[model samples]
Target: MTVEEVVSMVSLIEELEAREAAARVRVEELESQIAELMARLEAERETWSRLRVTRETVAEVVAEMSVPDTAGEPGPEEPAEPAPVRVVGAVMVPHWREGLLVDALPDVYRDIVEVVADASTPMQAKQIVPRIGLPAVTAKIEGTPGKLKRLVERGWLTEDQPGLFALAHRATVESGEGAER
Candidate 1:
């Protein structure tokens, strides 16, 4: 073989090896980036899971608190005890029953019931807002509907038609003339 041809072949082989080494370095960098992104994705998924669990736990606690404990019953001869009062950080209306009174409700909820009971006709949330001592602003008016709906769900109030709230007929009859009015 000619020396010149041999030298040319050796130079071409060295150039190919240099290109291969550069490609390997680029592949390593991309692999590192992929690994980092995977770890970040895992962290985000864990955070999402924790938030969902926390929300579920809070809902469970709130549901359990909705019904006050009535474990100890008084003897028939003993004077009937007054219903236990439920003091809560947030508004919680207990389901109205034969024995439960408006007084058993939290202050805001009782105020809402009293306002509904006193009204001559079924009232809208906007109309009832001012009477409950809240300002007749958009925000206050907007927030009242949820409370009104919750009352209906708990049987303390009724919504025979949409957006019109009234004291439930059964609640009135059970609690006597005051609630009926």
Candidate 2:
């Protein structure tokens, strides 16, 4: 090759190498960012897991409290009335009873109860999602079934069929008849 041609090729190779180095730097930066994001995601997942366990544990404790103690009556020293439902960090689902009103539930659970009570026929989780002012997106829709199942477990709602949900036995608060209960 001619000397001039060789010089030009050398300059082009230098530019290409510079570009490749910049690309490698950019890749490293992205990898670092990805690693940070992955760590944050894992921490978030752990928090979510802990919160779920807390919720389930609270539900179990509430259920146990609701069951009438068959062993014996409270001694004269102990109060005769059952302990009132307690609200901890997040309001827990209480076992429904004659005097337990829908208003006592957490906002979302209350909304779900009201929606099911309002529906003429039993409704599915997807159908209930939008009625409570939530977007009917797949994530919300998919998440709702778990709430519905929890409500069923807590006696706030019933699953007449596989997916269809209805109020367990209570009327809506708006009705005023069973509002206090």
Candidate 3:
């Protein structure tokens, strides 16, 4: 064959090889899809059978509902007192203070934890902020600088660097109070 014809044939061979590779990939994808569809079909069949059984039971119950009541109006033969409601076991512990704390902070802070406990080097509050909560990070970082400085003095937080305050661990702050437990 001529060089041009040979080159053209080589290019066609390469294109055919690429197409065959693509077809193989498509076949694998189709086989996986078939497996998933078969699984779904089996589950659907089981659910349909369950629904049919439920419908049959409901039909029997509906037939029972149509039966005439044995008792008409009872002429003052019934007892006067109604039954008392019953609750079982260690039913509830009403921690009102914890409820107030939870209400004070929007729920998002539940996820947020400012890790100030036992690290060789202190961490920045900004990095710790994302670790703490979703509601708003402002609980650890908010308000005017003067007020914030006062909060820092009050030991609510410890500034690791400028514009960065690591939340003082609750245990450290609560240690002085009898509520420390």
Q: Tell me the TM-score of each prediction against the true structure.
A: 0.51, 0.57, 0.35
**Can you write out model 2's per-residue Cα lDDT over 1-181, one digit (the tens) per residue?**
9999999999999999999999999999999999999999889867876787678667667667665673587888777666655545545676676666777777898889888888899999889999999999975886688788888988888897999998877553554344443
Ranking by lDDT: 2, 1, 3
lDDT of 1 by residue, 1-181 (tens): 9999999999999999999999999999999999999899789867866775566446436855654455678568644554543444434466777767787676677778888888889999999899989999976786678778878988889999999999985464346444432
Against the unseen true structure, what C-alpha lDDT does each candidate score?
Answer: 0.76, 0.79, 0.46
Q: Once superposed on the true structure, which residue ranges of model 2 sit more than 4 Å away at CA?
A: 1-74, 85-90, 171-181
Q: Residue 12 CA error for candidate 1 (Å)?
A: 86
TM-score of 1: 0.51
lDDT of 2: 0.79
lDDT of 3 by residue, 1-181 (tens): 8999999999999999999999999999999999999999889867876775566445435533543343565348543322222223211111112112222221232122124333335445445444444233543433223222333554445666875555454554233233312
1 or 2, greater by lDDT: 2
Clash list (residue pairs), candidate 1: none
